[model samples]
Target chain A: MSDEAIKKENLSEEVNIREAGGGGWLYSDVVKDHFFNPRNFMRYGEEEKFEFNAMGRVGSPACGDEMVLWLKIEPETEKIKECRWRTFGCGSAIASTSVLSEMITEKDGMKIEDALKIKPQDIIARLGGLPDRKIHCSVLGDKALQAAINDYFRKTGKHERVLTAGAKVIDSVLNITDKDIEEAVLEGAKTIEDLQKKLKIGALGKDSLPAAEELLKFYLEKYFKS
Target chain B: MLPKPKKIREIYFDHAATAYTDERVVKAMLPYYSKTYGNPSSLHRAGREANAAVNDSRRKIAQILHALPENIIFVGGGTASDNLAIYGMARAHEQRGKHIITIPIEHHAILHPLEDLEKQGWKITKVKVNEEGFVSPEEIYKSIRPDTVLISVMYTNNEIGVIEPIADIGRVILKYRKEHNTPYPYFHTDACQAAGYLSLDVEKLHVDFLTLNGSKIYGPKGIGALYIRRGIKIKPMILGGGQERNLNAGTENVPGIVGLAKALEIAQNEKEKENKKMRKLSLYLWKKIQEKIQNIKLNGPEIGDDRLSSNLNITFMDIEGESLLLYLDEYGIMCSTGSACTSESLEPSHVLRALGMPYEYAHGSLRFSLGRRNTKQDVDYLMKYLPVIVEQLREMSPVRMEKQKHARYK
Candidate 1:
């Protein structure tokens, strides 16, 4: 069959490309667009070329995804003049960060405060929705943006405005923090035994055990609604 | 207004996922579906004709595998064949023993059934593979216990295409069975990936049970077979009227069976010629990719006799596999990735993990499995876009290989 005829048939039939014979297109058109031609991404070895004051990094390579956001903020209006990012992640992750960079810097750039308020849902909606399992990919951009905004606040000497999500140290002996515990809970650790298996939290003594258990309960309830 | 879709030429390189049905196989199966459509169990003339076709196909498959026709039992697919071999044998022989041995890099079809068996108080020992994804026969021999009932391994790994020493492991099992004077541990090999490329003679391999899938051999999907050595008792997983020696009881898939037989015949006849062509093309592609792309690591055994001629799995450092896969798809080049982001559980491929590959490298791996339809021109087209896509992704990636690793690539 002719290429054009096959394309026409595919479009008319509306065959879900993913279900077709040989691993056809898997993402939405918008995702394809962004993934193919990403917006506001720093070119390779050109991170220093774009003069950005504050930077935030989230996720980890061990987790199979990591993202870094570089933002140039205008001091006077607290506006993000430019937002560039790089990610070691999947197609959904690349698309999420690409769209996020546009949303933050488009239309003469959004205010840093407004950018911080943008949730993963807004990013997913803008990108025509990611797969259910890929919702976590969207969250990387939101978390990285908050981290960058916090960096900006710290840079501007607005110490009180620096909102910590879960960075505070909860266990002094193991140097385990609330953020570590929260991540453990999010990673499917329900009971204190599971958390202990992962983080070895309360290793030193029984004194910190109660506090760790309390924090684990709070995180479980916060994330799982249990 | 919607943009007009561009006419992009497609280049398929994911045959490891599944292959397109061969036209010859399709033609062979058409008559069974329409003209000779009859339940083989029926006593009528039409049913007898259908039964004859099934028997002929069974004889052809048996001749190829060097096994008797009665040893071949057809099932739904590769997974079904694997489930039958593992679950059927384990359940039937549970009174003898409850321990099983397998390599960690087995396909989920084998691993999941073993996991289910584990919940039933069965002990599963997953012998580790080396860095090149080669399972050691010595380790398999050491892992065997008096109570071990089955030892399952794949002829060739699907993800990295590393060819295990199945015949060697088979020899070890034979020695153990003779020395112990007990037919306690029966050897099984999942040869779905090896059917089209490697030898399937059951006598040479010394396997009690072997699995073959139709889809992997360019036949119809949802059809596969398990070769059970005669006199080895196995409980049936699917219960119904007597069919497939009362082991797999269901209406036979005559068309699929016919197609599978034809496909296997063609595959065996053309195996040497296709392997030579595929080896040359795979080497050409890998050499060009290595020369063009930087910071890449070959995952499996250096593409040669130790690996399938059609397989090339490479990890492009600092870039995730799924992003590269999608970018390649934009140009109508299809492939697969071992990246966690592509899977439902958000974990990298268990095969890569079993190779002692770190999470970073595992997530960056991509598999290119060539097939009968692919050619040198197709590899050229892939090369044209692959380097560009890798470079693009690397630019947008925050991770960088250490200087030592980068120097090794250089």
Candidate 2:
């Protein structure tokens, strides 16, 4: 149709623009799939896998939006391998979960602490930007992801493992030489709680724990260096 | 995708947040986006032509409200109009009295400024709403004193769909001022959520300031007008090329303004019919949700004509609002919790809490606000999915199921 004809038609009706997809802040396909057919919507584990459940089980019935995240983790890597969520939310949410699932799949073995850094904006950016109001749906994704991670660590006896990762711990409580700590880690001093107990207390000052340099270096690499 | 169960249209129940641009509003706004495109501020014929369109829209908006064209200051949307009203009042009337009184139920546009005003040393008093979500006239009267410069009570509660009596409350302030005969308490009502549900006239309502939003009335967003009664001295919130009487300074959103005016016209024109249709739907949805789903409570108003036509805020016990929403999303039913602004908060709704709703039940509330575009079929579809979805989600919730089991046994 010519411009004049389009103008005439628009004048006769409403100003409906048929723009090609991939224009907004969110990927239309990702949003569509998530909204239309949300994946991992329900938890499929036995009672043992769940660490803790803080369902958003109360509040406004008007939205009819609910999110449930059932989580499981690898004890060795402290990585989140499985997450099942049910969102009574909008398309943006469905897309957010899909994107979140993709991220989880890619980082299958990356530590949970690293996964915690993923924000709603990252999910939206994966698609594009979302409509302004739909930003909350993205935030819900972020919340579900965190809830699952928190659930995983809390369920098993590895709640203390969060500090063992790329974390900055000023160690004066327990002291070990860098080489000894490295040797122990290689020899499977796995959880830092075990490492602390194994190394024993009073062997070092708070700032004198094995290679404070490395902890600071890791922190710098992840955040401060940028 | 489950063998593609055919294509389905999403249910839109978040109209209180915004309405999809009505087809009529779109038709009205089309000229500015194309052939009739001209800067209203220009000196040339094109500019003059644009200026006429702007004036025409302004006049149409004025006609709907029975206000003078000069009173309608069109800006981006509800938020902008609100800021213009509250900020303009605070700055312009700084010397008059440094205090302002508004209700707890006011939108953030009003609440945020009142907060800002507090930082600026203005004593801001938030009037409390009762368990029924009604802000009393007595509270307004008690809050207003010698220093209370401006009194802003909304014409309606946005979240819970409670309509406030502006005339009754505004009269109290007027009576209070008759004795003092000096300090005129500027009254502003953010009627964005109530545009389609109520008849807004600055004169008959006797409000000093009133806000109209396009999106709420099915006009395009990013455009609305604030009616500041003549001789109401308020400073400009947005400063630019002296557009909007040098009060709001940005070059106007012409298409938005046009669209808004037409939307308002259509809303006013069709208010009675829309109200009847929506009241029936709201009442029906409310009844159906309760009959079909167990442990549901109607939060704002008992099912009646009193509630906002499109608002259906239902509270389901032991149900998480967001989870139910997700379950319903599978069936393509789109809705919102009360106030899209703070959906991610872990706390209960401020509006519902103020309404004396218990935190447990308040947190479980879901606002299924309806719109002009929604129909009986949509409600029927919602009715079909709601009970099943709620039951499914609740069963998945071990605690909820256990609680129900405990209750049933008891």
Candidate 3:
């Protein structure tokens, strides 16, 4: 190779994790550390070891990633005693969940309410920020945690404590609602592209198209007379 | 301190992405960069020397392809060659026709240009590939319209390594040309991935245009070649000092051309030996992978078919491809995933989708393109860790069919 080409080949091999975002930022040291050695991740055959009370799942294989979070709460203090997760996703997703698990369990434990306050941005901030395209990977774990929290509240007969406050933020990003999908399907926006053109589903929230399509399928089954 | 972790060997299995520049090719290119560096357009002795090197390299490449040296036009890379071939031919012959035909599985280099032409009042016919990743000649023949001016197909797919029936398709185009007594529709093949192993005789393939890049065949990057049949008309895309017979306008990349020629010479000379080695390694890896992993689907043409000798693409059910890629990268085994997450837009590979692969399986696909440098030990090393990684990722996957149960970490 030319000297320059050899130099480039060496440089490429040494490069740390890079943001999938086009900006070409290198992933943070913390992110790399967690990605290279994720913590509190459940492994094969270890599924029954934790004996967790509630679990939350988010994302989907069709969407290219998914995360499952298992939480154990202390009844008296209502503090999260343990948090374990398994995410089938890119490095950002795995690292975000690993960091989030450590953050929630540190200094005794985060209270259930406080844990619910954790946002996708908080996980990203702890990891020194993820690529723009990968921020949604981080969101999966938090959403799964929220679902698990809701599951916990519903099982404990504390329905009033179930927090569904972040629905609006997600809806705006997705740029479509259940009613919009129902209306579009009813109006014969049958294909994904037709629905996309009608609703502009992927204009901002590129990662949200799959979820919208899944929701559209449900709505179609419910409302489509045929 | 904890015992130092055992150092993992880095094994690259993504040659289809790009090959490592061979040292011999580099050595051949080094002197031209500085010692003999001069603009080929200059009238000085240094310029003559550089010009001579360029001519020699062109002659060498032409010799291998069984084409006249004058027909070779050197450009920047494979994309440039494709753009020049498609856009140049389409615009130059616009008066005669404004229609193009290509397969759905063509590289973006060909497809994007066709789409651009569509905006300029060109009709495009995208033929579909079969499940085995074969584009039928009959399908192309059926799609041919009187106004169709160009047909571009890739010699082999970069992702799945399935070889297209370029020769058969060429015969189809030739038949039309003879019957209609007009050269309205010209055949173009992006032979970028086929240069290392496949036959490149333009007459045998019956192609009016062919594209080959330096980067994919262990040569330096930033250089490519287009073979335009002697009588074919093409318009220049970039306007500047006339170069490459006024088709491509740029000062010759002398060193890059030298490297490309050297790379191609070595590859063609050792093609049979290297092909045998890669085929054996690829089959071994595929067999081992099948024996180890469950619910895995091999993508592309089956072994012993007319597939690239160095590629093995597989999809693991219930596991995300990118996750598995990361895990493998952790162990210093480099490969690629067809998952949408790796792409800008979160959609699976269009080639896989064209082959009628489901979205879920396409999202879980991985490509392992072996090279001559790879050994059985490298495949063994990959096999050792791959099954474990797949099993673990499956357990973590939401779409995994296994029953859900409580899992705890200590």
User: TM-score for the first chain of model 2?
Assistant: 0.50
Which runs of model 1 end up more than 4 angstroms from their true locations?
A1-25, A165-226, B1-7, B403-410
How many steric overlaps does candidate 3 have?
Answer: 2
Candidate 2 lDDT by residue in tens digits, B14-45:
88877788887788788898887888999998
Model 1 lDDT, full chain set: 0.85
Off by over 4 Å in 2: A1-226, B1-7, B339-348, B401-410
TM-score of each: 0.89, 0.68, 0.85
The alpha-carbon deviation from the true structure for residue A193 of candidate 2, after best TM-score superposition, in angstroms, is: 29
lDDT of 3 by residue, B100-150 (tens): 999888899999999988998889999888887898999998888888899
Backbone clashes in model 2: 41
What shift in Å separates residue A122 of candidate 2 from its native position after superposition? 17
TM-score of chain B in each prediction: 0.97, 0.93, 0.96
TM-score of structure candidate 2: 0.68
Error of 1 at B72 (Å): 0.4
Give the lowest summed-lDDT range of ten residues in model 3 chain B: B401-410
Question: Model 3, B54: alpha-carbon shift in Å?
Answer: 1.3
